[model samples]
Target chain A: MTEDELGGRLAATAEAAVQRLAAALGAAPLAGETARPARLLAAMRHGVLGGGKRLRPALVVETARLFGRDIDDGHGDILLAAAALECVHCYSLVHDDLPAMDDDDIRRGQPTVHRAFDEATAILAGDALLTLAFDLLADPAGEPDAAIRIRLVTRLARAAGMGGMVGGQMLDLAAEGRFDAPAAPMGEAEVRSLQAMKTGALLRFAVDAGAMLGRASGADAAWLARYGDLVGLAFQLADDLLDATADAATVGKATGKDAGRGKATLVALHGVEAARRRLDDLVAEAEAVLQPFGERADALVAIARFIAARPS
Target chain B: MTEDELGGRLAATAEAAVQRLAAALGAAPLAGETARPARLLAAMRHGVLGGGKRLRPALVVETARLFGRDIDDGHGDILLAAAALECVHCYSLVHDDLPAMDDDDIRRGQPTVHRAFDEATAILAGDALLTLAFDLLADPAGEPDAAIRIRLVTRLARAAGMGGMVGGQMLDLAAEGRFDAPAAPMGEAEVRSLQAMKTGALLRFAVDAGAMLGRASGADAAWLARYGDLVGLAFQLADDLLDATADAATVGKATGKDAGRGKATLVALHGVEAARRRLDDLVAEAEAVLQPFGERADALVAIARFIAARPS
Candidate 1:
């Protein structure tokens, strides 16, 4: 796909996901909710509805669209699932930007949740958004099958929880050094492992969750998972490169902080040229994994390239 | 049940829940985890394994024991489920203790998670603990039935998410006043509403979840749910009373700060004598709701009264 076409496709998918998400967080309380606190709802909307690329949800939507079985009760069901993933992604951003964490003042051309609201609201908003991920997935309208809903919950909990994204974050902090501990020098292998858990896990699960929704055969699902793994690594590599090369305006957030923070990445280890080559190879491998799906996988192939070269 | 017998039962159940939780958070990584980051694992262990009454899990276990259905794959299954609820409860405490939130330095006579760990680690630890709740429930051994697991996830997402506990927290903060807004006056009804969402929801979910685990008949589930609601209300009311009457050492945390914090509670509205009378009524109503379970619910009854008259 051409750059413009890919951008258009991504934008369309993001718009759809946003609309679905707005409805999910609408005024009507879900069952068991006594009442929705207005301030909290506004903060949640601020954290989630604020503009971003929405790449994660697009991956989920595109992957599910590429696969078969028609398990979703409605077309919107897939979008709801995609939106759920975005909730997790957005919540991570909110918490990650807290003054106690990354301390970023801006995200996606807007003030970080803690900056826009208060620290407490940002924290609670992130918590609620994380909870909503499971809420959206397990809600009856989100999916038709109980088995699939539970599987999604399990997969998501693993990807986003202690063992996955959260654990990775802790490792990242440790590498940056604590008050008593000196910075830990991570070799390429250690850096890769840390990044895999921090960023790669959720991206991989996004694609894997889409496969579960589509009920793909075991072989097909396995291949898709492998493809997701490559895509995840490439996505992070590009992000590191973007941080190094792009200005804050271009990236729509603070840039050039990785070096200052002493964050270790392969891009930093191998130089920009090597990282560029790796991205190309990842896109190629990702496309190859989808070869068996034939021309039906074109959108996913485009998305893989897009993620690998996001800023461009 | 005498006070001594009740205390023994609660302590014994707390022991079992703690053991199950330790096993759940052991060194072995569950599925989809790359590896448990050592520092993160320690922080999570601190937040969770640092003790409390374990009352929420006790409610789950006792309620499940009261019903009849052999759905759990292993006897430990119920304990696992109970531990899951405790994870949610403990996670809330961790986040709530953050400097930006409640700013609590002590819990259960130990330094709160944030006091022991850094702010970022405490935040991540709470996030991980919350994620583990779903992980333990959906794990193959957590429950054998996908349908039941999905139900639990949905129920939990509601009880713990924006519409429930998180929402309540937001409301609590809003009432405390933001930089731009003055503290909003909350009457008894509003206070009850806020407390129900903030604290009561999860407690109610504990008993309802136990009923779910045992696959109680709809009528039985309804009655059990009613008991949970009363218990939840009574539990919060007693907590407010404790905050008003107890010293920091006795409560094992900061106490008598609710009034200073401008936290609106019925205990504040009705005074101690009236609040005590209400607690008595709440316990009576709770026991009546469990009447259908006959002597099988004696332990739960005693537990409810204990909660209402805790710190005696």
Candidate 2:
């Protein structure tokens, strides 16, 4: 598929995710034993709905689609998986934005959840969103097989929990010398390990979950997993590049904070030009692996190219 | 069984939960892509291992044992379920003690996770602990049937998520006039609803998970759920009574603050004498529901009685 052919397809997938997420949040079953849309639910909806690229869900759906999973029928079970993954992503943001964490006042150009609703509510909302992700996964309507569903639950829990995003966040803070006085400057390897846990794991799961849900086993699964790893690295590299070059307005959040905080990212260790070249290499390696799958993986390849050449 | 016969069984149950929880957190699978334990893991251990009666896990193991579940073989998978539920319980306490939430300086006679570590680490530890709950439930070895495991996951998510514990917490905050001015005076029913969500839900899940995990379907499951509901009410009422009458040292945390904050409880709505009566009634109802099981349920009945007569 050409760029023109893939036009609006990504956006369309994003839109589908947004719609499903909105429906899920809007009609959420629990109001803490009440039937009305309580303040907690409203805060959750606020944290989740509105903006962002919906990139994670796109990875899930597009990868599932590549494996011949039918999403035409109410998006099959893929949308639920997609939405559940997005919940983890969004919950991370909500917690990360707390006054105690990143202390950001705005997300997607709107007031953060804590700012809109108080700190306690934001904390509870983040907790609820995280719990909701598991709830969605365990829903009987999602995966056809209980065993597969449990596997998905375990993968997501690992990715979002210890050794994954939360653990990565702690490492990131430690690198910032939060616990020690002027912690030793981190090198590239440490930075890569940190990044792999902080963001790479979830992005990896996006593709891994899709392939697994589609029952792509053995070599087919191994190849997809490889593709996920490359894409995860490429996506984060591009994000760092955007942070280096793009304005806060363009990226829809603060920019250039890495250098400001003296944090060691690959971009900080190596120049922006080197990061760009590395990104190119990543995209090439990512695309090369999909050659075995022919045009069925065109969407996945397009997503890889898109990641390498983001909004900047 | 006589109280003399029951002897240290409750203490033994509590001890079992603590040991299992220690192993789970000590040997946590993900230190975020690292094989060694990380700061996040340490903080999680700090939050979960050092304190509390492990009542939730006891409720799980005892209930399952009543249905012939075994512990002689390393506590069986019921211990995993027990450990998993305790994680949720621990996570809530960690988050609740945050400066932005309850501003608690200590938990179980020691500094809270935030005071012991930094706020960020405490938050991350709590997140990991919560995620670990599902990880335990979804573990292939936890339950023989994948279908049964998924059901356990779903039930836990609901009990802990919105319209349950988190939602109940929001209501409690709102009742404190955090979001709205005065928020109208809460009556007995309103207080009951708030208490149910804030504490009752998880207490309910403890027995519900045990019964389901033990394959006690049909009428057996229904009776256990009813018993869970009554026990949940009894536990909270007893807690409220303690807050009203006991000193901080006995409970290992602040007491009388519930009324100081003007937080309404059944104990506050009706005087201490009335609350005690209510506790008695709840325990009776709880034990009555288990009449079908006869002597096998003596442990459960004793537990309900113990809940009504906490540290007081």
Candidate 3:
């Protein structure tokens, strides 16, 4: 698949995710026998429906497609997984942009959820979104097999909970020298560990969740996890590189926050040149992980390259 | 059972929940490959381990025992479910005490999580606890049956999420007249709906979840759910009445917050005397719901009366 073809596929996948999410959310009763509060729904839509590349869902769908014999019919399970993953991603973004956390006013070129709604609503919106992710996974209509749904819940919760995303956020917050006791200056290994937990965990889960949905086992699951890890690392490196280099208009959120906050990131610990080299190496490592699947993994390889090459 | 026996039983149940919760939370890995952050764990412990009646867990244990053949050995499933529910309850207390929400400094005669820790940690602790609730339910060893675990997740998620606890909270917040656009005074029906969603939903789920863990059938589940509904209402009404009449020393938290905040509550709407009358009626309704179980439900009947009569 050429770059243009991958771009089109990515766009189409993102569109489908957005539509499914909107429909699913629309159909959701916010309260039992009561309409979902319009304001809360609006705040959730603002956080979620706002434009992004939808890279996480794309990875999920693409990974599932690798194992799917009939890709068309298999999309239901994959889409559900993808949508659930995106909910977590969006919730993280919403919470990460809170006044108490990252304090960012803009996300994806729009006001942050807290700024759009009130702080309490933003907090609740993020909470609701996170809860909804598990709800979506555990839905009988999503994954027919109870065992599969349970695995999804366990894995997704691990990835999104304290051990993964929330823990990473705490580490990141501590690194910012913001709390009563500023964390000691972090080294390269520490930064990597922080990034791995804070950012890489969910990205890794995205691919692994897709594989689970695909019913991939043994070597297939291991290879996809490896692919996800490398790509997740690469994605963060690319993001740090963007933070260091990209303009706010191009990146859609404030840039250079790492340097400004004195937060320890690989791009800060290692210079831009070294970080860029490492990102390239990771993309290569990611590609190598998929080599066993041959041409069937072309899109995933394209994804890895896209991670390395995307401007913002 | 006599009142004194019921008090001893409730105290024992509360103690078991506390011990189990401490162990479960201690075993929790705040992050993968890292000791759960000492401070975060401390904050979580501060929030959860603080003394409370632990009435929710008692309800879970008693409800589960209503169906258990060997009540002695069957505590594992019920305890897991109980611990998970308490986590949610504790998490709600932590967040609800935040400056952005209720802004209370004291809870159960101790500093609130945000008061003891920073706002950010309190938020994350609540988030972690909420996530941990689902994690506990999804544990392979907990229920063994994926279908059972999935049902637990589904029901708990609904009870805790926007349509249930969170949505009810939003309604309560809106009723507080704190927002720029203050909501009009809620009627008794609206207050009932809000209370049902906010406080009653989780309480309803507590009994229902206990029944699920006990493998109750259709009619049994329905009866327990109805019992939970009536008892949950009684619980909240009793709480409100306590808020109205009890001193800070007795209630442990600040009293008269509702009147001071102009919070729309049934106690405020119906006045103290009427609220007490309604509490008795609810306790009666709750007892009536358990009539089919006859003498086997003696403990539950005792529970309903205990709920109505317990001093702060």
Candidate 4:
């Protein structure tokens, strides 16, 4: 298949995977009947299922494919892991938009959860989603080996926890305006570090997790990890550039607002042109790492390009 | 050995297991490099290692003992699982004490994490701990079959997520004060339902997870689960009684405060005498379930008695 056709196919697969996950999660039995907590459940579902590009899940499927495994070989575990990642991502967005954090009202072209619900509900929903992510991985469907399942769960935890996403967020919060002061402008090193922790960690997890589900080992696993990291970095740089250059309507969220908020960004540090160039470099690096896999790497290559070239 | 002696031995083992787990987690390569967010690591440690009774870990070790498994079985997956349970337990406590949740200022006689750090930091710490719990299980620590590890992770997730602790908390929040209002007066049934979801779920998870670690199945697993449920309910009722009757200094935090806060409690719903009688009945019922296991069940029975009779 042509690269675009392959990319379209993978995206379709990811979409179906997410829909299946939602259905599966819905069918899970409640502990008992204690009035359902309708509002909390609604907020949790909204935060999780609100539309976005299923990049993380896509990476998982593509990486598994590259490792010579079809979707059916522990696809349930992969989808559950993907669903969990989405939960963390959604929770972060919800919390980020809170008054204590970024204080914005719009997210994905709709009122943020805190705006739709209250701050408490938003916070609880975020907390619930974060916990629910672990829950999803802990009890993946189709019953993979318990030991392997544990490994996948651990990877997600480390990626999403202090040493990863939360760490990046803390640094971002601390480094806001200090980037452009008498000191360095958040520098390539610092920006890269932050992006690696925040975005790359989870993306890398998706790739590594997909490999785990397929039981990939040795060099194959290492290559997928490298691919995940490269794609993750490119993805973030593209995001930084989009925030600077895209209109809010096109981006499906507020844009150019990072500068207004004094948040550190690649565009702010290295300029839009430099950020775009850097994204190209990352994409190239990612593609190079996948060369040994020959045609099997096609999906990964297309994904890297799609990340760097995405309109928003 | 007598039941008390067996219980004492098991408690000591649980403590040693926890210490070993702390060392293992501390020595993890991933724990290094605070070059990102030092506070997150510190918060995680403080929240996790902060003092509390290691009830869940004890349940794991004792249940494994009952199943005739050693600590080193499956290369310490059992230990790792135990540690992971503590992390989840700690995370729940941290979040449960949050301003938006329980609004507590102190826990186990120390300033609650939210009071020590900012609310955001505490929230992030709890989130990190919760994620780390699953991570610990998924990573290959011992020689457990991958399938078994996955099952354990799934079980933990179910207990800790929406249908378990989260569900119970929501019920408690919604049912506050209404338990004793003119309409309902929250009877034994409601209290049992709440305790089942809250305390019983995690305790049951602890036993089942330990059994999974030991590769126990069939009737043995069912008995352990039933034993766990009974013990868990007894533990909660004892807690409710202590809240009503113990001094704050002795309890190590606030006691008799639930009533003042208009929170539902067994004492509030059924009165102190009835609550005490119920505790006795629970202990007797729990012992009856253990009657089939003979000496192997002694430690569990002793633990149940301890829960019923603890002064604090």
Candidate 5:
């Protein structure tokens, strides 16, 4: 099949999986008495189902496929894992947009949660979503292996917590306004570390978690993990490039916004041409890691290329 | 043993267990090239071990004893679980003391985390601790049963999330200044619900998690859960009463402070006499739940009574 056709097919599969996963998560009894706080549930659903490229879920499903596991056989566990990651991502977005954090008024082409609801409710909603991520992963109905499931939880926790996302955020906060100065300009090494942690960790987690569920072991698991890390870094560079080059409408959120705020970004530190070259290098390195898997690795290879080329 | 003597012994056991658990958690991996962040690690250790009654760990031990399991056999998992709960509790205190929340400066006779660190670090520290709680429980070396471990994770998440602690905080915030109004003082039922969720959930999780780890099932597990819930509420009421009558030095933290803030507390709504009476009723109920387990349940029962009558 042509690359576009393959991409289309993968996209359709991912969409179907996401729908199934969302339904399963929604059916969970742990949401508590539905009648008492209907609005909270509504807000949760809205945030979870809101528009964005379900790239993380796609990575999970594709990686599982690469491991010779039929997505349909263990689809429930895969979806639950995807759902958990999405919940964390959504919660981060909600909190990031809060007045205390990034203070953005828009997200995913809609009014932010604090704008849609009150600030306190929005904060609580974010907190609820975060806890729910752990709840969904820990549910007994999905992923019966205790050790593997625990690994998944640990992976996501590390990705979302201080050493990963939060630490990167601290660095970003510290790097503001210092990017343009003659003294430093946020060295390439520092920028890479920041992006790898802040954005790449979760993406890598998506792929690695799916592989774990599929029981990939020994060298295969290590290979997939390395692939994930490389692609995760590439994904962030692509995002930085898009943020610098794309318009707000095209990105469906806000674009060129980071530059306006003096945030350290690949395109900001290194010019667009240099950033694009670095993206090419990263993508090539990611594809090289997948070479041993041959045809089974095609989807991941294509994904890296697409991530680099996508408009948003 | 007399109640005081029994209580003292259990308290000593808990202190020893806490020390052991901290040491186990502190042992760094020999292979890693870089050391973990010392300050962050210290903050986490301080937040967890800085001193509370260690009531949760005690309950875990006592519940395991009632199940005919030796504390030493499952001590590692129990301590990890207790440490996890304490982390959650400490994080809540740190965030709750922020200027936006309770704005308290003193906690456990020391400056609260936000006062000690910057507001941003305090926020991240709390977030880290919250995430670390799940990470600790999901450790493969500790709890081997994935399904049961998942259940423990889900239980803690629900209890600590919006429907539990955060929900209680919202209700308390909404009810501020209205506790003394003519229309119906914060009713007994509301206070019970708030305390049950805010404090009782974690305590209940502590006992039940220990029971689960010990492989207790059927009626024993159910009874332990009941015992835990009652004691958790009694503990909250005792805290409220102490806040109403104890000196700051005696409580080891600010006392009589909630009333000044117009926060709706059990003692503020119910007369001190009524609150004390309720505590007595709760202690009796808790002891009755433990009766079927015979003398093995003695430590837990005594702890419950002590929680209601402790000087601080």
Candidate 6:
């Protein structure tokens, strides 16, 4: 497909997923017993209802489709799973943008949660979003198999939890030189590992979780995970390139942040030419991993290429 | 039993639970796939291992004992669950103390996480602890039943998530009066709901979760839940009184924070005398709910009274 067509398809999928998620959040009862407080709900809606790419949710939906289902089939179940992942992604962004963290003021062309509302509300919104992610995963209405639900929760928790994204964040902060004692200059391996955990882990979970939900057995699950890892690496490389090259307006958020903060990235370590070369190879590897599924993996292949090719 | 003897028993239970929890935190592998970063783990340990009453863990242990399993039996399972709940509690405290929130510098007589570490570390620590709580819940080694594990995840997520603790926090902030436009003063019912969700929800979960672990059923589970609600109220009312009346040294943290923040509380609405009287009634109701369990519930009865009587 042409790149524009591919972009259109991805946008369409993300739009549909966001609609379902918005509805779910709007109707979600507090404590599963009563209506959520209106003000709190508004804060949550402010954080989530504001538009973004919804790439994580699209990944989930597309990955689930690989196991002999289409977007039209099991739409509710697939969208719910996608929405849960999206919640985690959005929560991470909210927390990352806090004055204590990256301190960014804008996201997806809108004011950050802490900026639009307040820091306290931003923190709670992130907390609630993260909590709601798991709640949505364990939701019986979407998936009836208790075992699968448990596994999904376990994987998502691991990916989002201390050992994964949160741990990576700590490492990232340390890498950004502090005033009192600057961080030791990091090598390529360290940067790769940090990115793997901080950004790649959840992306990996998106596909791995899809495999679990699809009941992909040992071999099939392994292939998806491999694909996920390669795509994750490629996505980050592209992001690094964007940060190195794109403007804040094109990226829809701050760019040149890594270099400004003295944070290392593969692109920073190996120049833009090398980074682009590696990203292309990673995309090819990602596509090859889907060879076993043949034509059924077309959407995912498109997604991998899109990750590498997106301008911002 | 004499009040002093009762205090001794509660202290002993809390101490044991804390030790087990500390050990578990030390040994926990992130995501069961990798070691957590040393610095991040230290931050998490700091937040969790810092001393507190451990009343929630005690509640879990004591309530489970009523259903036929003592702390010594299924000790790993019980401690893990209690630790999970405590993690959530500690995480909330860490976040609540952020400069953007309550802005406290000390907790449990030590520097708060942000003060001890930094805002980034504190924020990440809270996120990690919250994530670890769910990780502990879905632990296959502890609760082998997938159905039960999923249920545990669902219940805990609900209690800790938007509708419960997080939602309550938002209400608490609103009650504290908005910076741009102060909130209308909360009435008694508003204050009650805020307290119920903020503190009571998790306390209720501690007992209700114990019943889940013990496989309590029908009327047994209902009684435990009702008992939990009463004790949760009693615990909060007592806490409000202590906040209004205690000193920082006695409370092990800042007191008079409620009044300072303009945060509404039961004691704030109804003077200390009325609040104390209601607490007594709550304790009585909590004990009365345990009547059918007979002497098997002695520890729980003691717990109810302790909730009303603790000085700090």
Candidate 5 lDDT tens digits, B70-91:
5457444556666677667777
List model 5 lDDT by residue over A1-312, tens digit each: 457866796678667655854674455445431111334555666666777777887788788888776555744456678778878888777766767666788788888886776555566566667887887787655666766777788788878766666556655655554222322346778787777767877888888887887788778888888888888777888887777666544673343555454456767777889989998998888888889889887888888887888877
> For each candidate, what is the lDDT?
0.84, 0.82, 0.80, 0.72, 0.70, 0.81
Candidate 2 error regions (>4 Å): A2-7, A28-37, A74-76, A246-262, B2-7, B28-37, B72-76, B246-262
What's each prediction's TM-score? 0.94, 0.93, 0.92, 0.85, 0.83, 0.93
> What is the full ranking by TM-score, best candidate first?
1, 2, 6, 3, 4, 5
User: How well is each residue in B1-312 modelled by candidate 2, as lDDT tens digits?
Assistant: 766655477678778777877777677355224432378888999999987877888888888887788665543467788889999999999999999988999888999999998898888899999999998888766677888889889888888888788878888888777775666668888888777788888988999888977789788988998888898888888887877776445673344555455577777788888888888888889888999899889988988887888784
Query: What is the per-candidate TM-score for chain B?
Result: 0.92, 0.90, 0.90, 0.85, 0.84, 0.90
Weakest 10 consecutive residues, lDDT, candidate 5 chain A?
A29-38
Interface RMSD of each: 0.9, 2.8, 2.6, 3.3, 3.9, 1.8
lDDT digits (tens) for residues A1-312 of candidate 1: 677887897899899889988998885886789889887888899999988888888788778877653324464377777888899889999999999998999988889988888899999999999988888888777667888888888889989988899989888888877535777667899899889999999999889978887777899889999999998888888887886576445673333455555667887799878998988999999999999998878878988887876764
How closely does chain A match the true chain A in each prediction, as TM-score? 0.92, 0.91, 0.91, 0.86, 0.86, 0.91
Clashing pairs in 2: A32-B163, A163-B31, A163-B32
User: What is model 1's interface RMSD?
Assistant: 0.9
Backbone clash pairs for candidate 6 read none
Which parts of model 6 have CA positions greater than 4 angstroms off? A1-5, A28-35, A70-76, A246-262, B1-16, B28-35, B72-76, B246-263
- Looking at candidate 1 chain B, the ten consecutive residues that score lowest on lDDT are B67-76
Minimum summed lDDT over a 10-residue window in model 5 chain B is located at B29-38
Quickly count the clashes in candidate 5: 1
**Ranking 4 against 6 by DockQ, winner:** 6
* DockQ, 0 to 1 scale, candidate 5: 0.32
Local accuracy of candidate 2 as per-residue lDDT tens digits, A1-312: 777666588778777777777777777465224332279888999899867878888888888887788556553467888889999999999999998898999999999999998889899999999998998888767777888888899899888888788888888888777785665778998888888888899988999888977889788878888898899899889988877776445663343455445478788789788999999999999899989988999999998998788784
| Winner by TM-score | 1
Q: On lDDT, who's better, 3 or 6?
A: 6
User: What is candidate 3's lDDT per residue for B1-312, written digit by digit as tens?
Assistant: 898888898899888888877986677463233335566678888989899988888888888778872224733455777888999999988988888888999999998988887888888888878887887788765666789889889888888887788878887888777667857767788888788878888888888877887788999999898999998788888877877776445673444555555566787787788988888888888878888888878888998888887786
- For residues A1-312, could you state the per-residue lDDT of candidate 6 as single tens digits? 566776787898888778867886777575433336677677778788798777788788778778865455743376777888888888888999999899999988989989988899899999998888888888886666888888888788888877788888888888886424677768998888888889888999999877776778899999999999998899889988887776445673343556566687887788889998999899889988999999888888988998888877
Which ranking of candidates, highest lDDT first? 1, 2, 6, 3, 4, 5
Superposition error at B15 for model 5 (Å): 4.1
